[model samples]
Target: MGTLSGNLQRPVIAASAVCIASISSDFRDKFWPNKSSDTCSSLEQANSFSLPNSLNEPKSSWVSKISVSKLSNLSFVTRIRIPVPDINNLIPVSRSSSVSSFLYSSLTSSHALINAYQSAELVKAAKPASYTYDVSSTPSEVLYRWHLPDPKSIDVTGSSDCSSVKSRTVVVLLGWLGAKQKHLNRYAEWYTSRGYHAITFTFPMSKILSYQVGGKAEQDIQLLVNHLADWLEEDGKNLVFHTFSNTGWLTYGVILEKLQRSDSSLMGRIRGCIVDSAPVAAPDPQVWASGFSAAFLKKNSVATKGVTSEQSATIKEGNKTTVEAKPELTETALLVILKKFFEVVLNIPTVNRRLSDVLGLLTSQQPSCPQLYIYSSADRVIPAGSVESFIDGQRRNGREVRACNFISTPHVDHFRNDPKLYSSQLTQFLDYCVLTCCTSS
Candidate 1:
């Protein structure tokens, strides 16, 4: 089914294993939906022998899967031999503000989208730029991973004085549906830079549904939290989380509550939590803020006022009534496209209950340690208010909450939005999660 078109021979351990850079179906589908195969889920869940795709002109019938032997170090790229119609050939006009802000994990996404934005003639276009992270690998990257044993396979030993709990570490990176692969690297780097082990999703998810962003993702995130606790309880190691976007935020809320239910040693190891663009609250408030943000996207940006009331109605009642967000295809031209995928995929009512339950546990019941909330005000996806609202609530409840915001762009492009600014905030945040979480008061 799959063939190793590239290097077939394996080199002995130079670095031994580099975190797999290969783009899986999840990464492909989310970024290049057009280039994706009919079978995306297959590749993400299971290693494909022959990923079915037609590359090169020869045999249209000839399909290929990924080579599992080189799974760890190999990077697989889908080479489209034939010229397919440009799915990314988005509508050639933008109407929002000329400045568009985005989560810039790489120059590829930033330059690509920005240039695309320049030629568009849709509504108003405010094209905010993106920024990338500056740090290279510190000898620190391996140190963190080395310390944390696998969540499912860590060992625990009681200390002589009983003052210390010797356990393996586990950190999970929960990403949203449409998030890019590079962001994962950002995550690994962020955690490693701070001396935290990088634990990828036991389940690597690149493509998630819209509207399903919140509550459902919460289940995935929380599962890891609880599962790791059980993992550490046996091994006597601690658990940490580095969650991204909606998926990660939802998980934080869920796991906190689950841990509060159990007051064992596992719960004690729940030291620090790192949240990026994670919304502890529901998307409705963000939905409300969309009116203002959308207008900011048009050619001539408008505030959410009487003059722009009609636009708001069009977005809310325009297409899918069951869903609050507009369709991704039609979502173009305007900033409506910036709506977080969770808003489109998640059910609001259910997500609400989960969020409320989590908050209640953190406040009314046993409290969690400090949580580092990292966000960008210019984030076009989740509102700045969402971050403010969640952090505010946490502080009020007597939880340790620190918030850092990256302005001038939307979503994940903190690096590209303003690299210098992004770097400064990111390292500081990393230091906080590492030192604060590891050291006991």
Candidate 2:
């Protein structure tokens, strides 16, 4: 009991010291302005206060200083009053009060002043890390974030220190299934810093599922394509595609198909493309199943998975255990065998079937634009061999294609495996594309 009491008192002592130091700084700054530089320096060094471990709670305060009276009179007093909850009301600072109540009240009052300063500091820290805006699309809303290039960096006309600023390119990122906004925001920060407006979105798998087996165009894909096409027509912004995983590839396929069909100026606006761990020509059914399980079952909680209406009804009928068992399939070798069954017996096309057609179109097309393909040799989902083959085909068709192959990097995780290399390579790819686009323009 004595040790605990001593431990508790330590925080009170430290907070009292902080309160004194804060008051001392106020006195020095206000009353001792005429003091010598050496004196002020010494006072500052003396005013530095260390905090105790227990009272290191997040600092919060509404006010820092309150002047009750001017210093001209002895009755005049200037003091910093921090707002803390009334212990009488909250904890009842009396004999009947519990130990927890006393502890809470003591800790609260002790850190009241410092907490105010720290709370203000915390609010400053909590300010938006970056500026972002969102735009809604058909089927589901697409979140669009703008990373405007630094005006000072581009203001070459005013500053002699400025180098030539190339035209800003708008990067469109199509993220994989189940990607959150914060996940893509990190990618956006990279582009914004390097002078690119990055527009990012995720494809709705429910809508993706509505499309036919042969990568057929459905209303969902058409709606997204139309939305993008309209945006393209509004401005002649040089557009670049940064695709992640097979899901992104599927969306890209739909976009390319829409661009090909529409009379809009979108195709010409497309300057370059960068595919990350995608364009899998022939995806294994087991791998696709594993990816789906990871996205729907393992990653999401049961309440939040947004299971289909039919699946939800089925769950009500007592097949919940069977549904729960899907994630377990994520571990078993039987998934590979099941992939063959789904493909051969059920005659179901892999999700990449439609995307593979788009890959073919990219390869066989005239004036094949510069493209950067990033893949890993050890990706379990999208085989590196498929990406290599696609690149080889593109090369044969006289397309300018570059491939960054990493050894043993997992699917859609090359960035996490080595962020420096990933970022540098992406910057290089963007630079090359910018130069080519400028020259072509």
For TM-score, the strongest prediction is 2
lDDT by residue (tens digit), candidate 2, 1-441: 223234446665676588666754554343223434332123223423322223223242211122211111111111322233221112212334443344444433322322232222211222212222221111123333334443333433423221122323567788886675567877876776655556666654433334354332355455445444533433434578888887777667667766887854467777788898877665456556556544554434221223444554655564544433232433454455546544552233443455456656555652345898998655556666689888898788788888887654566778877798899888787767665434344
lDDT per model vs. reference: 0.41, 0.52
User: Cα lDDT for residue 424, model 1?
Assistant: 74
State how far residue 12 of model 1 sits from its true place (Å). 41
Give the Cα-based TM-score of candidate 2 against the true structure.
0.54
Candidate 2 CA-lDDT value: 0.52
